[model samples]
Target: MAGDSSFDQDKNKLAEYETSSSGSYKSSRGCFNSKTGELMGRNFFSWIKLLSFFFIFCGVMSTLFGLCMGIFFQTLDYYIPKLKIEDSMIGSNPGLGYRPAGGLGFKTINGDYKGLSIYSSLIWFRHGGDGNFDRLRENLDKFLEEYEPGFFANQGASLTKCDFESKPKLTDESCEFNKEWLSDQGADIKCISAEHYGYYYGKPCILIKLNRIYDWFPDPYDINEVRNHSTMPLSLKNDIEKIYEEKCDDDPNKYCPYLNMVWLHCDGEDDPDKENLGLVSYTPFRGFPGYFFPYRNQRGYLSPVVMVQLKNPTPAVLMNLECTAWARNIRHNRLKREGLVHFELLMD
Candidate 1:
């Protein structure tokens, strides 16, 4: 009987140990599942972070390439300036207007050719009318006294009357004007058309009278936009014509022809000897880019410019002037426009 009791006790202890072991195993399994879920969540976040970094890297690379292309094209456009004479801003204004004369504006960042004098000193003059060798010398003299030593003056068309009359032949009106102007000056300034009648440098010369200079070169402070923008003289076009006719009738000996029509330039230009050429109005001024940028427009801030007006700034009336003494020859004059003569400077 004692042995049977001992066996029963042993069986009970074994059952208790088995139950405890089972519970412990269940708890361990639950803990393992929770750990696995946390690991999965962390892996998802890592994948998301990796994808975001990849996208950011691609965006940065694309921006860099775009910037590089922009710079490359901008630089290329500046150096390779393709100039078209017909589309030039300077020569675009037609027969009778105050078109901007195109020349180099020397900015004095550190050297000479600065301020108002620089602007005023830089100008080019055109030569027109039939060649009366005597009158030619007078014009040359005037140019020397008024302009820089390096100024270039080119002779356009033979000294003559209206070259572009409605019928294209030189008109009687032009002839009469030249005769009168020469008579008034007591010097010959005749103009007779040659086989060809055109601009001096593949461009047309503005053929306004000497008396009309004030209209174009007015004070910048003047609020008159018409005077500022006008290329025509200040009087009625027909009224002035009548006056000219009346003057011719009254004093036959005191008449001057009107050759005040500027030409529109185009291709097929011949460069005058640089030594003889006065100014560079061959090409037009294309502002900052391919836009019309007038210096002192009523709209925006006026761009600083150099204006050089030569009004009777001569040494003496009876002085001998060398043709090349005070003029600059650009690309054309450096090789062409090189000739010498005596001239004077006289303008009111």
Candidate 2:
């Protein structure tokens, strides 16, 4: 046959090359299933772009944790340390006043009103009148001409002259004004004059002091555990056992006893009435006393004047005074109370 017709034309070209490779492998698996559905739609937009970058990284870490707790409670009062009491550290409970005399607004002396009015130095003088004592003596004479070398040496006073009649000559043994050990304890040195006992007794003689604190101490075993605790005050524990039997010979650390105790209470007296004339009488003569010698930063260390003499005050009437300083760990009723010093006197 012609070689059996060339083997049936090579078996019809091997069945037309296997049906053209089975339609080219089903069009290359439909172009690899459209590139595997475009790589599963780019892995579902990369999981919604990684969940929108994890909610923008938790909204920038919760806005930086609420701005660092609002800047740490807004500087927590210049870093926590106001009227500390409770485990004794003693050093920042100072501030007590009364040096205005008649300078902070000089309200009147010869004409009688003697200062304090602008609604009584803005309620700090407490209260008096005459329609605000000419604006409380022109804002207390512009605040005593801006604290004039007063406010306890403008608040630092490590003793800058309270000399009281010359007494400083000790070659050595560290003697910076001992006035002969405070005149060997009879104590009456005297030399803190801002001269304003209402210019010598026409009434308002307020010169109370104490407002310098640099190296404060007061913790001789917390003042004998606050004078043998029991909530003290049996007349202040017999005045701290008569200041440890006449100045610490009975040894409560040999002396540092009267840690600050001044108490005047005109309208709140337990027994005031010092010769009532519309009542107002005081007498803490010459500086607070008991025993407090350890100033340390002693720049000639001298801060012991507390004078208070307001007798016969009743010209226009408006007393209500209160000065308290008693200390156990120096707290004075905390904060803006700084251990008390309210005022209000109207001796016309």
Candidate 3:
């Protein structure tokens, strides 16, 4: 009986050992599964990071390529001159009076006469009855009383209604309107008169003149660093020296800034030479809001003319309006048609 009891106890011991081994197997299996999940998560994150990096690289390359293409196209268009009709000559200054230096004038030898039609041309005009001061005062008074003040205030724009009431003093000395603040708006100093016109006898005439000395040949470079290197590309820093050597530099006078000036004049019978004409300035002849003038000429005619000059004289045409053969011929031909007074363009 004692031997049987001992065998049963050994069997019980073997069963306990088996149970402990099963628990350890489960714990090991769980640890292995957890490790596998962590590895998978790490792989997912790494793949996402790699994909984002690839997209970023592609975007950067695309931006660079786009910029390069834009620059190349711009350079091509700029270097190559487009064929444009010589409408500039036809649309230049009010026809009459004197031609300013480095100026262009438009003369209408034959055309239907209408003040509204003349206004349609690119010319600047301030009526002859009052000068800039009086006009400004009149306009300011009307503007203040009109809807402009309320409209500006509602839009959060700040402006003094009274500042321009009498004629604002010149804030900048370089501005012509400022220089003539106290005196007649036409006097003092301002931009060179590119064109002016008045009537002599009964013949309506137009004249173009330069208001300032060498106003046409203005500097192109806005910055000191890039001023001398206008022809060279800004991107190709290393190759700039070579580029400049290959391409000719910009000429201030030769650059035609898509500007044209013309003048128109009409006077009553009496003596044509005794007419006093007003000057007009027309800018950006094409599209909307064309032409503006603030002063009158010595002739007794209303002068509506266009004034054109380049902000940057790079493409070279603004220097001397006479430099252009077609332009010069047009002026000469138009002026000669007038019976009493004829214009001969002589370079000074």
Candidate 4:
């Protein structure tokens, strides 16, 4: 019985020694040991750590590539001339807009014109009623505030006194037509307020003005060619000649000889007579002249204001108007150009 117990103890000690030796060999040789499963667990954790590092490295590289690409495109856009159709240039073309546009006191006379037609139909009218004149004044005041803040102030026109709590009144001095210089040259400042000009002739009108762009100058050669081109209609040619005779007196040095003109055309395909009348008559009978002062980086220059009073038109007639600033560098191609503002007038 003693010998049996001693033999059992010796067998247990030998088994423990074999197990320890197997574990040591597995660890030193970097081999899997199925009994413990420790080497398998270590290898699984090592693979997870390696995959995590690879994913993190890929994420970092992708972010850096996106940032570099964005900067490159932005830089390229800045240096390139914008194509007007694509609108992909650094500075978008300055747009022309109307005042008292889609606001209180002005209501659309007809249903909204949609799609490509809306761009040509900017104005709608209703019969003159109470508050019309006041609303007109208010709208004009807002327009000047937005587009020409310093215009009246620069022209020595003063605002009416008002309490700090109340809105200030715009005076006649500030809003009235005071083109004394043009008047002195015998140019008619025909488009003042409807009341001042006798409203019986037409409806009270809103002012149509161009947004300011600094340092813009018309190309003189282009202006002369367009004005005197043989393709110009006979009536239009006569009108141009008459304007030069009356305003500039055939003198190149006098009052803006190369006036930047706005031409109005009927949008419909069937109006051949209206289209044939040529560019001169399109000048708003009371608004922007065929030409404007050539702005040559003049300091503190104020653009001229164009007030348009439409004569009673056949109801629901939409007029397509385009104001083009004729400069040599200002091209008018559909793909790439600046220097034109398009709008539509609808009379009801």
- Candidate that scores best on TM-score: 4
Clashes in each model (backbone N, CA, C under 3 Å)? 59, 10, 71, 5
On TM-score, the stronger of 1 and 4 is 4
Of candidate 2, the 10-residue stretch with the lowest lDDT total is 182-191
- Show where candidate 3 strays beyond 4 Å: 1-47, 50-57, 60-64, 67-71, 74-83, 86-348
The superposed Cα distance between candidate 2 and the true structure at residue 339, in angstroms, equals: 17
Per-residue alpha-carbon lDDT of candidate 1 for residues 220-307, written as tens digits (9 for 90 to 100): 1111222243432233233334534643344434323221122121111222222222332211110010011211112111111111
User: Model 3: how far is 278 from its true place, Å?
Assistant: 13
Between candidates 3 and 4, name the one with more favorable lDDT. Answer: 4
How would you encode candidate 4's per-residue C-alpha lDDT over 154-201 as one tens digit per residue? Answer: 543432222212332322222223333111122232334334321223
Stretches > 4 Å off in candidate 1: 1-86, 89-91, 94-118, 121-139, 142-166, 169-183, 186-348
80-160 per-residue lDDT for model 3 (tens digits):
223222343323322233322111223356752222221222222232333212222232233223222233233222222
Instruction: Please report how far candidate 4 places residue 56 from its true position, in Å.
Output: 25
lDDT of 3: 0.28
* Lowest summed lDDT window (length 10), candidate 1: 283-292
Better of 1 and 4 by lDDT: 4
List all candidate RMSDs to the true structure.
22.9, 23.4, 24.7, 14.4
Question: How should the candidates be ordered by TM-score, best one leading?
Answer: 4, 2, 3, 1
What residue runs in model 4 are displaced by over 4 Å at the alpha carbon?
1-95, 103-121, 130-137, 145-190, 193-206, 221-224, 227-237, 247-301, 333-338
